[model samples]
Target: MGVIAMDKKQITLYYSSENSIGKQLNAYVESSGKDHLTIDISKTNVTGTQWAELADGLNKNISDLVNTDHPDFKEAYGENSVDLDDDGWLKILNKNPSLLKNAIVIKGKDFIELTSASDFKQYMDPDSAGIEKPY
Candidate 1:
């Protein structure tokens, strides 16, 4: 099997300024000395292709991409009704991007969610987490 290498330069972030974790991620990326494209889903729309790319980066784990705790989601479906398949979650996110998780950091073909400020440091300095760069 051929191994795929990561292109660190091809980094993108989907984040919201309204969330603390997202705000911290934005600061980290700005100072991390890496080139990146930042998207605030609250103010802009993501195309279907872009959504697919984001989903792929998450290994198609739609639960990780969604904020089930968001009031809009909770009120509409109740707490236990989040058993959505990939397409179902994507459809919801397409209609309501604000319900997306705080921040998604896409580096090359891989991605990690910045759920907290500490997650930023852990993902950025992967060696400390006993993780090697995916290649």
Candidate 2:
């Protein structure tokens, strides 16, 4: 039989220069031998459509993506107030990208947000996605 090659899934990492953790996550992904492109959301303007798509990929609500602790968030919505929908949160993120959560990974059709370094292991697991591991 002839040799067969499975197409590799594409990986895109969204990071920010201001966030040291995000920079570390980018390095970790690279060292893990995964092929990916890095986009600095702080530098690049992310469109609402892209944000919506990412939200869809992770099956995440926009409120889940918001950094509630961010100053912008606190200033806009006081600690006790709770009356914002997903679209409203998305709009806040679009206007204040700094209020966005960090280290978003887009692998093929899968969208993920890595809050910690260990989360990368989930993607490396074969049962999870049959993705290649660095070690």
Question: For this target, which candidate reaches the highest TM-score against the unseen true structure?
Answer: 1
Root-mean-square deviation of candidate 1: 4.1
> Which pairs clash inside model 1?
none
Predicted candidate 1 versus true structure: per-residue lDDT over 1-135, tens digit per residue: 113233676567788776677777788878878677778777777765676666666676666778888988898889786677767877887777767876887776667766787776777676766542754
lDDT of each model, Cα atoms only? 0.72, 0.69
How many pairs of residues collide in each model?
A: 0, 0
Candidates in order, TM-scores: namely: 0.74, 0.72
Q: How close is candidate 2 to the true structure, as a TM-score?
A: 0.72
lDDT of each residue in 33-124, candidate 2, tens digit only: 76767777778877666777767667887677778887768888888766787678777776776777756887655667887666776776
